[model samples]
Target: MKVPFNSKDREVCIIGLGYVGLTLAVVMAEAGFKVTGVERNNHINDLVNSGKAHFLEIGLDARLEQQVKNGNLKSVISIDEVESASVYIITVGTPLVNNSKTTNLEAIKLVSEGVAKRLKADDIVILRSTVKIGVSRNVVKPLLDEAGVEYKLAFCPERTLEGKALAELVSLPQVVGGLDDASTMRASDIFGFLTPTIIRVTTLETAEIIKLINNTQRDLMFAFANEIAGYCDVVGISAREVINSANIGYPRSSLALPGPVGGPCLEKDPYILSEGIKALKGNPALALLGRTVNEELPKVTIENIQLLLDKKVTSQEKLKFTIAGLAFKGRPETSDLRGTLAIPIIDEIKRILPNVEIFGYDPACSNEEISSLGITPCGNLEDVFKDSSVLLFQNNNPAFEKLNLNSLSRLMRQNGIIYDLWSQFDGTSLELSNGVRYGGHGLMYLYNK
Candidate 1:
């Protein structure tokens, strides 16, 4: 028999001190548990040990600093560096492999192998990284079972937004699904430290699928809106007007607005869903379809831009282009660049305008980060638009809505185009002089609605 997790005194060892793991560690440490994080990256271990985070999140720095300084939290590069804990949380990255669209489970495999060697009777092991269904059973379980020790395993997905992870971690209902009934109760008891609402599903597979379904549903909704955008583009109608009017005072129709749909979850969850289904010889057309539509957005926008230039109103000579809102999203803004559509958009722009001067700006991302991605880091919104032939608003930052278009038009080259992918600004309301053109993703007709 093992110890019951009836109190916060149970020691915890969290693998992977990245975003998900680090936030969880801080929250749990603050919840009064002794927490140790294991990360392979030396730099990450140092940052955590020194009370700094690898990324930014509201209220994370202060809490992390307190935890490290107060001796409640510490991170190590290996599991062996610390004494065995009663609970283990695996929050490692399960990124997709290049070109395969299949999830790379090397991190999960390695972490599980390490944890298996350290397992004791009734030691709780929770998988928090998003993974394909049955991964907990088919892959991780077999590896851990090799140790021939009794342990509790569960899949408790970390389903929090990047920028708001700290706040959401304490509020969002923690979904717990375990290998068995005992496993479920124990994991549920563990996550109770984070949130009061512990949603216990039937099995580990149920928990895994819930995570995928949540993200995949979001991707599908956005894909539908983007499809509407494409349809409106072809018909020369306004998708924004159609969607807005349809949803206004209509309870049945809660349609999402058309916008650039790119983020870590939406970008890869669909493929992860498809990969899982394929192993069982099941075809997931809708899952893959959502991804296909969302993936086509960058290329489609580039094609539209090329058509604008082919009109010959804007001079191609000495042309300069700028992309603002380079983060994956603007609302719930984050500095994370993973799975951002900005990358594909940049690639498409380069293909059309090779050797063209391209600049990038994002309120959330640093100039050095922008420059590291091969884009010239732009300083201010005015400098981003000054003398620029084209400016693309690739995200939904509300700050873009406040631009003084009439004044900025004077600075833009004649017939300069401003394309807002999220249609953040009401272009129709702002009349542009100096031959400057304003447009957006869904249609040439830009509406604030």
Candidate 2:
């Protein structure tokens, strides 16, 4: 029998209250279901119960507070508090293992063991974490079966963007697959409350691969853009202008902009996809190559900066390099620094110019956090611009969008170089009084001059 969509008896227990899990829990609670969030981290559990979010997400705080006030949502450190729920959704992180490309299932295994202990007949169990292919069937299902409890198991991978989770959760079509027919129906019925569209697939592996391919394809598109940008650099052409003109009035061209492509999902998903392909004794040459191209972008950026420095600067020891914006992305806006390209860029710069003074600043990140990454964090934007010979805008933060170019230009030394990686400024028209040179990715006209 299919469970009713808005049945009051169907309580939800969302495991792992991270970005994916917390957003889903809040939305589910807002949809009029009693929700319990199970988290292993004490700090996260406390933050959720106190009506605050540990990380930044657009419109998450107010909704979370409302859900807490209405008694629709509660967070706990143990899964024992989740025993009463009719549906269990696992959204734990499945990061790559240390120094290896293999998918680490330790968190999933631990959560599965906990869920298995409390397994009850007819209870719906959904895996929403991004995982390697067959993880839902091979890794998660076996744990539940060993407990000798009857439950419906399904894989419904998370596909929402980090900053737009709540909005995308309701608007985007959810892909759901299950171990059996009844399991699929139960999983679909539960997610139906969040969104009207639920795409039902035949098996668990399909759902897992669907999410993997979604991100991997995106990674490949970005890699292609970056690759083209590199080629444009060699030929003295603007990649941005070329892409924009090509995409104009064209439905076939959906090219992404070239920049540092780093985040929790894009940086790691391709590797996971390639690993899955390798496990099946198949070659994932294209996927691996795409990952290589994206990963090498930071180094390419560093090399371009070095060329500018060698031509403009008289002494390398006096050069102060300032990097602005540390977050992975800035459009939707978030404080998440996981797999941020800024770190690698900084590391590569330090390797190339060991004596150059490097400073970093970001509106979303803290001084302590930046210091933890071995970057000397600036207290203010002026401090970053002061005495800086090279300013690199790494993140696409909105704060950087409304910048007073004249005021900032006045602060920097003469002939100071500005590398706008995201094309935040007009490379063709920027005329600073202090002779500050501005160049962006694919804007070879500025570099050629």
Q: Which model scores highest in lDDT?
A: 2
TM-score, every prediction? 0.94, 0.96
Error of 2 at 445 (Å): 3.1
lDDT (Cα, 0-100) at 279 in candidate 1:
93
What is model 2's C-alpha RMSD?
A: 2.1
In TM-score terms, candidate 1 sits at 0.94
The digit string of per-residue lDDT tens for model 1 on 1-449 reads 12244553369999998889999999888787789999999998999999998776767888899999999899998999967588989999889997898999999999999998998887888999999989999999999997798999999999998888888888999999999999999998777877879999999999999989899999999999999988887777888888999999999998999888877788998889889998989988788788889999999898888778667454555678899888788877677788889999999988976746889888778888899778898898888888787889888775777778878878887777888787676666777866778887886644222
| Top TM-score prediction, candidate number | 2
Q: Model 2 compared with the native: what TM-score? A: 0.96
Q: Per-residue alpha-carbon lDDT of model 2 for 55-86, expressed as tens digits?
A: 88877889999999999899998998764887
- C-alpha displacement of 82 in model 2, angstroms? 2.9
| Residue pair clashes in candidate 2 | none
